[model samples]
Target: MVIGPDGCGFDMRSPSEMEADDARREADEAAHAPRMAVTSRIRRVAQPPDGYLPLSLFDEVRLADPVPLYAFEDVPADVTGLAVDYLSRVARGVPARDAFRVPLAGARLVGRSADAERLLAMVDGFSDRSVRAACLLCGFDAASRRGPARWRAGRVIDPGPATVYNVRRMVARTLRFMDRVGPVVWEGFTFDGGYTDRVTSGDGDLLTADGLWDLKVSRWPPNPTYTLQLLVYWRLGLHSTHPEYLRVRRLGLYNARSDTMWSVPAARIGADAVRAVERDVIGYADGL
Candidate 1:
């Protein structure tokens, strides 16, 4: 018998049908290719609002502060280091909770040393690599003790009894110095409110109605770099759209260890200096 079109062994499609199937597949691929191109273009154009400014651009900019410089003479190395660390915390407005969270070897040394001399001898004998660590531990320990009796009162978390009394003793002296200096409004004042994207941010230890103050807990005297740092802050403030920007009319540094404060007139940090810094920053950014 002759095979019918619906027979089980028959070829279902003709050559024309096969050609039409190939044409449809090619058309589908062509239709999708444009979509893929458009998607790629969108991705290429998408970018952050601030665009791509290198970090170096922000670093290159320097500002000026009119504050006078101070010289610290004949301060003990250990005392200076301790004072710098303590005052730096205070200046940054670091909460007692946060400061106490920092791990210190002094915490372990607590109740371990029988006397000050023994503790000193132990610390003195520490390897060069361990000396800084020991000092930091001692500083933290002393600060923790003094926190309860002073400004950080009720904030000191008990790491344990004091094993190093001398560290606490040194901390007490530093606290007294802080107390004698009296209170300033800008302690821990941060200038991040108006920071533009891709720009550097800064903070001052103290902010007054008329000026901004940076705290330096250092044995060394103020230098141009410090002044420039303050100057940059001033420029950032001046350029800021924030209402409080105008309030910062002065710049200065407070040497916590030396108990000295130096303030410069805001006017002294001129537009020229700001422009110069901006130029340098832009040049650097371009190079990158």
Candidate 2:
């Protein structure tokens, strides 16, 4: 529930918050920027003995190369990730009211406009707010509320048929991954507790009965940075006062674009590598 700067200290504040304390936030970011360089550290130090895509336990859950339900045109991966994540919640029966309340509230402040109404009508009801949230998360203001693809001339352009098709297709694949993994215990949660500081804090994607999972929409397989990110999340989870993370026995990546899943047991990651990241990159407190 605590929203702030992401792992690299990128300010995720609402537009209003940015305007209100821009100067102070910039100063703080400058002061802590060095410690926020966790991604660079991961590239340098985070290596697993078996490599990024270690043998998966779920080898039986085969997925074909992603085929678009509609004709495919390229879309931003970030936007696609957000849409699929939101739709996952809806598929799992999360009430529309429960998702994207933060960004939706921001949207409300922007007030109902013709574009907003048009957008709401465009999506299946469950995911309407999610599309709005994606817009803001991607970069929205009072000006660009309909999101990147659908915004034009200060108006909400109707989503092209193909865009909607691709989003639904991707969401279906994510649901397939979830069904294979097991029921989700948590989604869009941060490893909230003292282990995280302003610099090393981030929200993780999903946790199921099987393991902790991150949803990636990238076409490529898990890279060193992505693998290290998962490891760091696990360490933070263990260090956090939150007890639910103790249930995590594996770290996983589900690539929505490729429709493939990669996972490794916590024990498979090199202990020395993890320790090095804890001390050097994440900068966890002594004795944590």
RMSD of each: 18.7, 12.4
Question: Model-by-model lDDT, in order?
Answer: 0.42, 0.61
lDDT tens digits by residue: candidate 2, 1-288? 254566455556788877868878867875666443233345556455753434443232347854745545344555567667766776787754444443344344555444344443444443545454443332222123333343333333334556556666778899988888877898876766634342354667898875998888776666667876787778777877878788888888898777888888776666666766676667764423
TM-scores of the candidates in the order shown: 0.40, 0.66
Please state the error at residue 172 of candidate 1 in Å. Answer: 7.9
Q: After superposition, how far is residue 284 of candidate 2 from its true place, in Å?
A: 0.9
TM-score, model 1 to reference: 0.40
Model 1 alpha-carbon drift over 4 Å, by segment = 1-94, 98-183, 196-198, 240-242, 282-288
State the lDDT at 53 in candidate 2. 36
Steric clash pairs (candidate 1): 63-232, 64-231, 111-163, 186-206, 186-207
Strongest candidate by lDDT: 2
